[model samples]
Target: MSLLHTLAMHRAQLPLNALRAFEAAARHLNFTRAAIELCVSQGAVSHQVAQLERRLGTRLFHRLPRGLALTDDGQALVPVLADMFDRVGAVLDQYADGRFRAVLNIGVVGTFATGWLLHRLDGFARACPHIDLRVSTNNNRVDIAAEALDFAIRFGDGAWHGTFAEPLFEASLTPLCAPSIAARLSSPRDLAQESLLRSYRPDEWRRWFEASGSPQPVLRGPVFDSSALMVAAAANGLGVALAPAAMFTRELIAERLVQPFDIAVDAGRYWLTRLLSRKESDAMRSFRHWLLREAEAETPLCSE
Candidate 1:
């Protein structure tokens, strides 16, 4: 009957599981889907939501004939619960192997991921074992905030809107192809006679030709969405590919592909970018430092 006792009882009666069930159900607007996500039966999810509604003394969702719709109260509560869960999950993830391990989610360009980062990732793991790294590879385009990524390694001029960028290294574009194709190319002008395999960017071959002091030729090669595939096509003797020669070190060393000319054109550099609105976490800072150090060691001639 005491005020303090009543408050304590109220706190004790707060159902955490029911709250989570309701939140998940509300997010999906479907009890069945929420049950699937929570790995429970639909009846259990419905019961939890019903229990939560009774406790709160209000209806949080409307049970439609086909789907569910959140009430005003539910809409207001969803974000708060979501944030609370996220913060708690983040804290829990930080503790591993008797040490704090911060989770860092980064999106990298496919070219850089395959060409450089994947090969040297072991070194990063050794250097910073306390950081949990989750990497996703994308094309040059990405939405850092929408994807909830901590950092994005992309190829550009470091001018993305609402992003802070640090240059990693320059990936100069050059003509690469199978040895059979390379043997026929005595001059940059000779590229006109072969199938000039192209990437999404149409001006790459033109830029290389201009840099080589050769007149730009009319290109009628197949266009690929990724440099990796473009290089693969060239290695298979389909056509000459204009790509970053440094990225295909393995192919070049194995004699699967060869650079016919020494000339390379700079289109853009790889950059470590994060949204300006995002504050750097401990893990992000650590990874950024490690990346910059590695870039410096690998490409001493390239400047940030």
Candidate 2:
């Protein structure tokens, strides 16, 4: 055949059903299971695989008494076919209805993101019904480029490479414990008698003790990934957690937790960040506006 004719014939002779059947059967290594998965009879699945083997001029499976095993060719094709199918599915999932719903993927630092923004998501949802919001929480180790996040709420000094970081709000850390634990905390020296929970960040507890005009007590406790989790542990009476009271105001007001002392240490402020190359969509703009308004309203007059 001429090159053009051979290419045309090859395209025309491609067996989609056979390829799909072989891919599924090879993945499962059971014709019966592949038949059930593809909603076809076992005989049909077997016939499809036979046709695929003939087309490819290679055996794809080694039939055994118990089950089936994939040949080298089949093993290689499995990942390739799987990737192709996944790409097709992802493309279809991006477009819903007649219009494409804009997606705003956000990565949030575990602390305030969970304690505050998560609780207030309903309001934002109502504001932009068409905007699809996808939020994932991380422990300060976020990759804006790798994750393709449109924006992220992170806790730090608001300095990140290749990104514009806007200050959100300052966080203050104080010693929090259950009322049962608080009853034991009459003096600074008394803190040494109890187990203290700490976060991965060093110097927090020591600084808080200095701010309170108390000597550094013997600090022995479990280190936690997030303040939210640490405070929850403290509320459960596992240990005394030094965290930001502003982040846990609801818990304090509900009497679920208490601050044992008036001392609060200044941790770095939270920041809203996005890569410089990232273009803000209309939905992101709306969210940014709403977030600034809410933050301003929440900021205490004395702090301002």
Candidate 3:
């Protein structure tokens, strides 16, 4: 057989219904539940999946009395198939408005996403009700191109290549803790003896200390994956954490946490970034205008 012909045969071998059935069954692990998801009978789902296994010459699942477990082959195929389905669904949904609504999938940096955007999302929702906004959060590391995201809310100088970065807001780091912990802090010097919760960004604590005109405390403590988690630990009186005061304002006002010192350090600005190749859809434009307006209305806690 020719290489191209064999490749075509391989691609054409898996039936879409069988793939869908397998995807759902892999998720629920029960044939009955997969049938419900597929809107078909349990026996039909089993038959379709069996045909798929026969075609592939591999058993994709290990049938258990209660449910099923994906074989190694099934494990490898699920994510790829899931993504294919998701992208197909997204494209299909775009056609509903007569014109594609232009999906803007955003991967936000975790701190600002929790600290600021979550509180203000209702405004964006009201402003652009038709624009479908999908969001995911990560630490500072994200790729606009690889993730198929049109934009990213990232914390840094906004110098990413092949992209345009617009400064959204500035964030400053300060010592924040539970009021109980604040009560124990007699002075900036007293902080040196306390358990200092740290974020993955190591320079924050040192910068806050220098801004406070205090000796940099020995940087040793529980390191957290994200600032939001670190602050939560601080709020429990576990330790003091450095974070953007603006992001943590609600917590401070509710007395869930307190800023023990006025000293603040400039970390980086939050930015709205987009890839140059990505065209601005009506939905993208609408969302951006709304977001910029929201940022403008809210005064930054610190000015550079």
> Best candidate per lDDT, number?
1
For candidate 3, what is the lDDT? 0.82
What TM-score, to 2 decimals, does candidate 2 have?
0.81
Cα displacement (Å) at residue 252, model 3: 0.9
Choose 1 or 2, whichever is better by lDDT: 1
RMSD of candidates 1 onward, in order: 5.3, 4.6, 5.0
Best by TM-score: 2
lDDT of 1: 0.85
TM-score of each: 0.80, 0.81, 0.75
lDDT of 3 at 90: 81
**Span of 10 residues, lowest total lDDT, candidate 3:** 1-10
Clashes of each: 0, 0, 0
Instruction: Give stretches of model 1 more than 4 Å off.
Output: 1-13, 23-47, 60-87, 96-98, 300-304
Winner by lDDT between candidate 3 and candidate 1: 1
Per residue, candidate 3 scores C-alpha lDDT tens digits across 34-129 of 999889999989998898778776787999987899887777767877888998998999778786555668988887888778877887777776
Which TM-score value belongs to model 1? 0.80
Residue 220 deviation, candidate 1, in Å?
Answer: 0.7
lDDT of each: 0.85, 0.81, 0.82
